[model samples]
Target: MNKKTKFITIGIIAIFSFTSLFIFSFIFFPNLQTSINSSNDNGRTLQEEVSNITIIIDYSGVKDNEIYSNITLINFNTTVYHAILNCSEIKVQDYG
Candidate 1:
C-alpha cells in the first residue's frame, strides 16, 4: 500500500478502536454513565438543610462566654453572617 493509504488505514483503525471501547465501557459498567452525568445518585439533586445548630462565642478578654444552642435554620441562603444574625442570643455589630 502507498504511504497515504497506510496512514488513512491507521487513523480509521484508531478511531474505531476508541469508539468500540467507549461503547463497551457503557455496556459493561452501567453506573459509569451515571457517574459521568452527575455526582448525585439516580439523577436526584442534592438538598441543603440545616437544623439543631449551635454556636459558642468566647472572647479573649472577656470571662463570661456565650453559648447559642438549638438554633434551627431553614433558609437556603444561610451563610455565616446569616447564621450569626439568626441567633438572637448574640448581638450583631456592623462596622461598615
Candidate 2:
C-alpha cells in the first residue's frame, strides 16, 4: 500500500481502538457509570427527568417603543419539576 493509504488506515484503526476501549471500560466498570435511584415517582434517570420539563415565556408584551435605547430588557420563565424531587433519597425542607 502507498504511504498515504497506510497512514489513513492506521488513523482509522487508532480511532476505532480508542472508541472500543472507552465503551468497554464503561461496561466493565459498573461504578464508573452514573445511575439514579429507581424508586422515584417516575422510574426514569436524572437526565430523562430533567429533559421532560417544558417551559415557555412570551416577551411580546414588552414593546420597543416603551424602552429607552440605553436600557436593557431581560425576561425569563422559571419551571420546577416536582417529579425530580419525588425520589426516596431526597429530603425537602419547607421554610414557610
lDDT of 2 by residue, 59-84 (tens): 47684322212222122212243432
Cα misplacement distance, residue 73 of candidate 1 (Å): 1.2
How many pairs of residues in model 1 come into backbone collision?
0
**Residue 75 accuracy (lDDT) in model 2:** 29
- Cα lDDT of all candidates, in order? 0.72, 0.49
Most lDDT-accurate candidate: 1
Estimated TM-score for each candidate: 0.39, 0.30
> Which pairs, if any, clash in model 1?
none
For model 2 the TM-score comes to 0.30
Task: Check candidate 2 and list the clashing pairs.
Answer: none
